[model samples]
Target: MNILLKSSVLCASILLAACNSDDQQQSQTSSQTITESKYYQTKTPYQPQQDLNKYEAIPQGFQPVFTELVARHGSRGLSSIKYDLALYNLWKQAKAENALTPLGEKLGADLESMMKANILLGYGVEGIRQFGYGNETMSGIQEHRGIADRLLQRLPDLFKTASTQSASILVQSSGVDRAVDSAKFFTAELIQQHPQLKANITPMSYTSLASSSVPTVEDGGVDRFKLYFHSLNKEQDLATPLSASQQAIYDASQAYQKFEEDDAELINKLNELAKNTQAEQIAMRVLNPLFKPEFIKKLGTTGYIFSNTGSYTVTAPNGESITEKGKGKNSIASAVDAAAYVYELYSISGGMKTELKGIDFDQYMPLDAAKFYAEFNDANDFYSKGPSFTESKNVTSAIAQGLKQDLFKQVDAIVDKQQSHRAVLRFAHAEIIIPLATSLELHNMMQPLPLRQTYNYSNSAWRGEIVSPMAANLQWDIYQNTQGTTLVKMFYNEKETLFKSSCNYARYSSNSFYYDYLKLKQCYQIQ
Candidate 1:
């Protein structure tokens, strides 16, 4: 017979003997069918979108002026510039159109009060020059402009809240033209007092500088100039003998401040209007259709089930039982909604409970006795070859051996999992075992080598094991007088050894042990 064919036949014989039951054959076939059925279904993927412009309430006269100011002061810091510009522009537009609501009026008044306070708090013209336009200015126009850009990008709700009303609508529709005219007039008057200011008052650029390295004129350079004017206005109030042109610039700055503040109020009122509008409600609503039973069944056939108990039993067209098992639960069309609910609950609550209090499994055992018996039989069947056999001592023995091997594999797996644990163990062995073994080997190697035998060789000092070859292991004493030096005394033990011999010149040889001892003692500061 051919070797491969013989081997295949032998393997087939072994497995056939091991699982020779009708039920086992049926179960295996059903599992194979289930595995084959998974390639025929499709599922839709989920996607999420950013929600902007969903707020119900928005301030009036806010968006357009805000946009314009931001356009003018492109490099200004975001939060301050956006808020202040929005406030100022809203106020200016509301006043111009005479469409300011009560809330808009209040917003305008509050902004004016805040601006005056800010100036009194020591942010005047010189202060603006020092910190508003310079490269190092803390609240530079660029910074405020950046704030507005980010607000528009990241906070849509806030944007809508500041742009949803009639006042804002009117401003957005015609605010740009008016703002441009106002800015020109303001700039002209500002230049009269401080000719240097004219150099800095650039027009707002309509094109965005969001992705650019430089600011454009439309990005709110003028608004920043206006802020600088406010600072100048405050300076005029405190200056001694202010010039007529300075006074005019200061007055112009005040007027601009009032207009900006009023525009801010109108913007806030628009936010309220937007909130009450049906548009806002429709924007915020989310729709999700329910899954019908038939649709669920189709999804189920597409691998939507999540759990299995001894496979799925379906009545075939022939009225016979068809059982399926083994493949993992398909999650295609299952309770996706329920799954979402559970996911949200887990997100909110952290995780599921693993332990429950006040439950008695023992008391329920009698009611579950039939299941217990079936489980016992199933377990026995698992351990033995099948129910056809009376017992399976051989199989149990083989299983025990397999378990032992598996346990060793488990230990190896754990060690593989923790690199640090293995490294520490290896380090310990290197530190403890290798050193000890080397020390013993060295000791054995050191012994029996020929040496001068004037010192006592029979004593334990000469015979003792070497703990370490690098340190002192012996001591000696000698006596000396003017006549000569001579051997005096010695001691020997397992811990240490001693020997002494002496010779005389005027002093011992510098290379001799006595000389070395003296030098060592001197170097160590020993007397």
Candidate 2:
């Protein structure tokens, strides 16, 4: 059977790394289908994309031997209070001056409630008593917990064998509170759902490749350096481009640096959108409930920015911990800032649907305007992290090198019999996941757009929601036959997916997903 003929083209709702298409008609139709689902609401929060009971079967003789996964942290509240407070401060000004519309009248209380919700996001979630800004919400906890449970279902024999045979399953985290919290929720739920496996679950580290410890990014460890490779945070020294290789990969690369600085295009686009007649009309249409036209007009000329000086942490009497956030210098300046700020809140509110009740941020955000921002944000990310400029080659390729190396390192150990660990689970943020997704089929999703075209919904199939939503993940399960041939299969966001088309499947498997382990390594150009 010709595997290509049987492949069903998935829509944007299910963006998997795909097989090559020789059928131009199919590719054209598939692109049209995916592009239609790509508009608006790009910050889609977590929901499993794959059907649980419909996984493709492995080759008849292959038995699962090892598994590995790298997952983005589950849904979480706003990272900091700056955006919340900035909008709140603006609301205060509107309230004091009687500039609030009837709809806007309800915002003051809603903003306060939103702040409180973030402060308590993960509190009491699976025994976690205290969580604050940038921490997981109950939705987040359940996301990871459910993912772990599903994994057990996917590879029951391997997990069962590990439980009875004393094999290891290593877990690691990026050390940021949200990512670490995700790791905790995942492993805890794994043990809860299948108590027998607790004996084999361990925290992985480089030293002696030990079992039974959860090493954080703060441990000054190489594992963290690999998984948390994105240089997003500079404050706690979490992940930076200070290292020579990272610097070369990120800092010195001009194309990457332009992306780093957003190609200096983000602010201009925001400003342009703010001035557009249709956007202005829609802004008024959506925010009419919140602010008076005169006040909105006055806001058109004002300007301010939020800034953070520093922060600290606090420990509760019972050992619960929360970050003691310092007052950020926050304010809403002009009409543009107000719209952008509300969009920020609106964007975040999507993640808090399970947490915040009784208040809706939607009343302040117009879908058209929200989409304008989402597209720009998506473009920003596309250039910065996703399948970026192929002409430069080094841009996206270099950013994901560390993650690729780590995946190979763990799997190679299993293949070489140098490690007893049956699984390796990594918890990280979306920035890390995006690059990995692109690399999974760099020749496809990462392929450059046609000449003179730029990244946008209609022109590109990549959507942040499909590729790097909260709790996004990629997994690999390896199986071996009695005759000593090992084969591997990949799952993107828990969906069975083919490897790059250049990497053919096992000839004996009737065009199955399984790839011969050694040939698979060669296909990826991994030495």
Candidate 3:
């Protein structure tokens, strides 16, 4: 996990350490409380774990010949104006009803400020050069820049030759603004450090770098990734909805409550009615009847489950399009969505650069109380994107296959001298990164979750923070010796990681982390 800097590791002297000792003690005291709270997961900037200096030495005589990375976009602002507007409306209602706690009162202003900041940052704004629904934050820029700086340090020999020879580095992005920005920021730092790269960087876009969750007909009417994600759980509940007990705790403990004692009868009736209704509808009905229609609309018209050969059309990277059998939104009420804008309000208000702008709204939310919502979000991802629910095996496989093909193609091109690019960097979403990791059958990511089993960190090591934290990356550094023996070492989210169990080839005499490239490809039948 050691992020090496140019020419040396970061070294600190005794004076600086001693001077910060008192502050470190105070931080430790506060961090204990924050870390224990599940709300810690909800923090806006879920910082990646830092183990910057943990690198093991390369076997003597192996010089880095090529490197490739696939990384998630950096941390970004909340997507869309709808989230801000939705919460603002709800806050207005609470204020008008005189239900605002002192902490709650502060939330309205915070939301406005946050929305304005995002708007200025080009989120949901038109005519901005890099405008997108989710604009990257300054922290995001730093994240990529830091990654670039570290990579340069890690591959000094490779970069030295590339810079001297003026070899181009190919940068690919999904064409989304945040992703494009991530690529730019990363290379910006790279060129800044190695001036020769300024004339040799080429940024490109590949929109279909990953397949859609839904299936589509391919050329010759064949659908390679025909597994429809939504169809698999047409009626199955994927996310665990907030329980009545959890709701009651939020109402009683938080400074704000959506319902009053006078509404006890209505609450009782809604609770009973919720059993047979969709979770989304139940959530809205419990909070405010008037909000049901708008909230549902916000949920979108897509069906809850997957379908085959019905309506949805998926286009492949080669521009071939096949009509999918089914296309729809998920059926389960995203408990996270049922709760609507509440999650964003809590998440963005703390542990972010914006916190310095005077947002401390997390103080209003009790740590233990927020745990349910946090887990609810985790469950949503676990079932939908991770390995828990139906069709995940195929879904993840399909995702990995395409990226794997692209990866090996690049490797082949480099090895065959068909591609001159010394480095290949790809920027995409978590959907791409998570599944690719699963496809590689990386440890922790491959842990089994029975269809009925819910993902809990205590039981499994697959945490979102570790897998797809904003700016998360999987890096493969290829080294070659005088004999042309190529070896590959991988870093998952910057930590040296091992290959999945089935492909593990580390021998007693070899470094456990470094895998022989030929053996790895053979294990996966890549040829």
Whichever of 1 and 3 has more lDDT, that candidate is 3
State each model's CA lDDT, in order: 0.23, 0.63, 0.52
User: Model 2: clashing residue pairs?
Assistant: 103-289, 104-289, 104-290, 203-213, 302-333
Q: How close to the true structure is residue 182 of candidate 2, measured as C-alpha lDDT?
A: 76
Question: lDDT tens string, model 3, 452-494?
Answer: 4445544454545455667878899887788867778888767
lDDT of 1 at 301: 47
Residues 1-527 of candidate 2 have per-residue lDDT tens digits of 00000001111112222223433432453354335432223345676656779777777787999899999888778777766666676677678889887778888887777777876666555434345677777777788889999998888888887787554777777766667667777877777877777777664232121223335544532244456666633453434446655544444334444555664443342233223334344345556668887777776453423333233334544686655464765444455556666777777787687778857887777666666556556655665577755544646546677677668777788677786778888888786788777777632455654324456555565657667777888898888888878788887777666666677643335456577878778778886
The TM-score between candidate 1 and the true structure equals: 0.15
Estimate candidate 2's alpha-carbon lDDT, on a 0 to 1 scale: 0.63
Ranking by lDDT: 2, 3, 1
Model 3: residue 308 alpha-carbon error in angstroms: 33
RMSD of each: 41.4, 8.0, 16.3
**Over all chains combined, what TM-score does candidate 3 have?**
0.66
